[model samples]
Target: MKSRKAFGKLLQKYLEGKCSESERQLVEQWYELIDEAPRQDYTEKEWEALEYKLWRKIESESFETADESIESSKLGFWRTYRTGIAASVALLIGAGVWWYLGNQDTNPATIATQPTQSEIAIQDNTSSKPIKIDLEDGSTVTLSPHSQLQYPNHFAANKREVQLRGEALFEVSKDPEKPFYVITNEVVTKVLGTSFYVRSVDATKKIEVEVITGKVSVYEKEKVNNENPGVVLTPNHKVTFFTVEKHFITGLVEKPLPQIKSISKKPETFEFDDAPIGEVLNKLERVYGIDIELENDKLSTCPLTADITQQPLYTKLDIICATINGKYEVKGTTILISGKGCE
Candidate 1:
């Protein structure tokens, strides 16, 4: 028999990973007993007798000097309605058991159960084209063929969360107070209002998130916290999380588009005639919202004359590099250009 305060201290120690081997085993045994109690059937008389024995055990335990009298009074209340309290405890055990073990350090080999009972699951098994789903929060999801999505009928007050399997394109409605979250097996993507694509069907357990508009934050599901905020992606950028290695790699998307829809009302003109290289690159940066760096300051003085309005971003870069005898390479999410300065 242990006092309530002693049991609370032991549970706190277990949560903090500071319990000794024996103490850890004791807490786990308690968890197992509570987990299995809901399945057992006992008559009302048996239940009352059992609760009487348990209460007597608890009341017999001696408390510390400060809590001795207060704990005695509390035990007296439990003693009065011990039978009814026992039934209530049995009803709540299954629902509340997760609170004890959910925060424990998880082993990589362990598989977590999907907790989406309250959500509506939709699997695109027969659809030839992507299925569009409109959420209650005004967000939209384009579920790809053979993909699956689980979402609540109504979003929670503080946040909007949905689960995804396979692939989908999300167009989240703008709600700064209520951020949106897309949860998968490996990674979690968060945004206020943005359009992004998430793919998690890779055979190698790779999770990919590509941003088409606004901004997104991507992080591992198990390692989520304020200190480790994970990677932040903007328009035209993408991040890949390798599940096996637990690593993140960021880069530009294959075909970067102008950030016109979100940033600018009118499309930018990409036709330049004898414009300074710096000015041309600056214009490109503004239109695309991607950083471009020049290795040499003298390259800014070089003149460029080209009409790259019809070309893709990479093609535009190719033409620019060829004209100035330079080469460009992508590092993370930025494009770096290096070449000899004009005479």
Candidate 2:
């Protein structure tokens, strides 16, 4: 019996297109056997009934296998477990079983040399709508209208890289060794794990990156060869690069808000029940990485009770303000709240 580690290694290599013909066949045989396992004990009569059904279906086929009896048995086995096997295969691939389980000693240079064969592309045509692309590494990109994204079918062992044109939002999966890179015409954004937005508009001939959560590093690709390290951005900060000036300007994103999927904390639900407005704003600042200022200090004493969960940052603000007889405004990405004092 092949050890579990060895079997996982073999499966990984096959998925990476690095296995020899014999190794590929061996993996396929193992997969067949795994798929053929029966879920329930069957009597002879039950087996006969299954065989009869399979044969009835096969009678209409024009092609016949030379090993008729053996092929029929394989067909019967497949019919019993095909759905379960398909789901298991999808789960394994999504979980990066190969990368996680395989020996990690492969030379990075050699892995880089592996030719990329498959590329996947996604696009959005309307500015009013956006689309999301799930990458093999468990990261996701939300492409804005009039945008195009191209990525490889399988990531290189040493890095996860993709190309973007136009605008998009990225929620990257964390992998310390295999850094993620988003390359565009004007700038390249790199990070281990974070969420951010990138917009490269041709009319303006500039590229913009807004850090929504975590940290990101953005550099002009042309300047990197000259040893320019570029700028590192923390949450709520943004960097814009002008093609004409060949320079960058750092600022903040409009309407910065918390990224729900990334944060893992207890009582973290956006739900509020007569929570102190000050406490609510603090949590918002922490989650969204944006600063909030209470123009009227007395607003701090006010309490808000609402289930603003799942609402957009602005919507939640709207609800809170409406309840408190207050108002909020965006001033260069900072939320300033002003309201009548609550007695």
Candidate 3:
């Protein structure tokens, strides 16, 4: 192994994007060594100091050590300053452990959390159609190809938690006391009972959850310590967590259907005769549990006379907009309506 002083210098240069190819290779190898080595502990103060030093080095873009004598004997420099490098090694090992653990396996279903010995791991590597998995609590999961699910054979008394990788459509049974949790690489999706589609795309470094029914709460794993309530999504709403960026973007699904069918009473046939546009939109929003934003207040004067309760949401919007000589656009889960006012 290279002396800690030399390795640190190399790493600093690499972080500053100034290292030679050979130096970069050496730094990578050293990182591998640190990860494989057993962890060493440091006092809080020592760890803080080490982090401060690392940040200082990284931020000093034009740094160049003036110790030419130390560079000459790079391999043996640590022997002469054995005590100095030893102290640094302790911090390096700890930091290495942190980085390795954070990145080990991003597939939350299989790699994020360790389950008790009693839990079961279900995996599907075949490229065929989706696999249907029935949970103990009468819920069902349709797992896509190359996906894996880690769940208890029988949910514990407290909660029903499951981990997932790749894509899956979940149909959770209603249990107010025991919330159903789906842990993906980017976010933890929780719900009392609902159907949703979760997709973790490694290529895009994103995790997406689109709700088909009920409501869901999504929050970052890192934010669990804080009091952040995160975001709650109702039916037809969706959230995308960018793993690389560590942020979320909320939006609507491609086609939203009425979510109250199974839970609420049968909806009245969507029939309207000279109905105010605002009233018509209110009904559609209620049926889909989505937000409808009227961009033009003038649209209120445009009464709609159409029956579209049975049609798809987009189709319904198209017909209504056509009748009023207006247009509707979906922006981030909300429908925006604009048009020329009726005389």
Candidate 4:
């Protein structure tokens, strides 16, 4: 390691874009060393004092006595470099203080928290078909073509985090104590043992998260500490984060599927004879884990006789609405039915 004063001068020259190629590389290496160092909690004043003490210690350890004539020559060199050396020391200290403070002052809720010391493994899918990457924690990631995923070899005790670029489907394992976090450039999706699809390819485009099972929490990375921590989406629901607009839009997925837990327990017989519309809607809600609301309370009393087990959810809704002379519209994750009750 170079002496503090010498390193500071080189760093200052690099900042001003005056360093040669070799000097530039050397400064970058130093920066990487600083970045890889373990973080510590230190106030600005304390950091300054530490920096001073650290440099003094380094100087003392590396110090060497010189002959009187050599010392006189070195003193002459210092006289010429004094001003530049002072500015360099100040610049380096300022940068160190800024980095220490910035790292310590982050939101606890931020999904892109500091990574663990464990080695990270990256999976890049270059093939046309999606590739499945199994994690050590029993979770799996289906990385789409041209996409990449960076995950640790072993999850930390407190949380599981992964970085995604492009599109991927995450089937997280159940660990209530250690929630899973998927971080994209624009948004973060947090979950506890859920299956969800995330698409965040281009920064200029939109980032989307659609839940297949369980629940997911999606939020802007910059607004983690805000009163509104983004959108919480349940099964069949999705949230889209528009990068340019910096906002989220929540809605239902295009082709919503019945929740696995609900369907696996028992087979659903969508055959109903003279069943109340409310009862029918209630069954649909439970099956798909979606919300269905009626505009008129009386609409729920309308009788419906239909065999909808063979039809898709929307088609079944269409038949039910047509039978009662009603219409349905999707508002966010909920389906709304409006009609003047059956006469």
Identify the candidate with maximal TM-score: 4
RMSD of each: 12.9, 16.3, 13.4, 10.6
TM-score of each: 0.65, 0.49, 0.65, 0.66
lDDT, model 2? 0.68
lDDT of 2 by residue, 1-343 (tens): 2233354566667777888999877556544533332212333244345444444443433254546766777766754455343344434333333332422443333223322222433343455789778898899988888777767778888888777778889999999999998877757788999988899887998999988778888987655444555898988789889989898887667665564443455435678888888888888887777788999777887888888867877888888787668899876557899887565
lDDT winner:
4
The stretch of ten residues in a row with the least summed lDDT in candidate 4 is 30-39
Q: Write the per-residue lDDT of candidate 1 for residues 270-340, one digit (tens) a residue.
A: 88888998999998898898999999878887888889888999999998888778899999999999986
Q: Could you give candidate 4's per-residue lDDT for residues 198-278 as a string of tens digits?
A: 998684489999999888888887776678857999988998898888888899998888764434576677889999999
lDDT of each: 0.73, 0.68, 0.70, 0.74
Weakest lDDT window of 10 consecutive positions for candidate 3: 33-42
Candidate 2 weakest ten by summed lDDT: 109-118
- Ranking the candidates on lDDT from highest down gives 4, 1, 3, 2
Which TM-score value belongs to model 2? 0.49
Error of 3 at 101 (Å): 10
Model 3 Cα lDDT, one tens digit per residue, 14-65: 7677999987765554334233322233333444555565445433422435
Off by over 4 Å in 1: 1-119, 261-264, 341-343
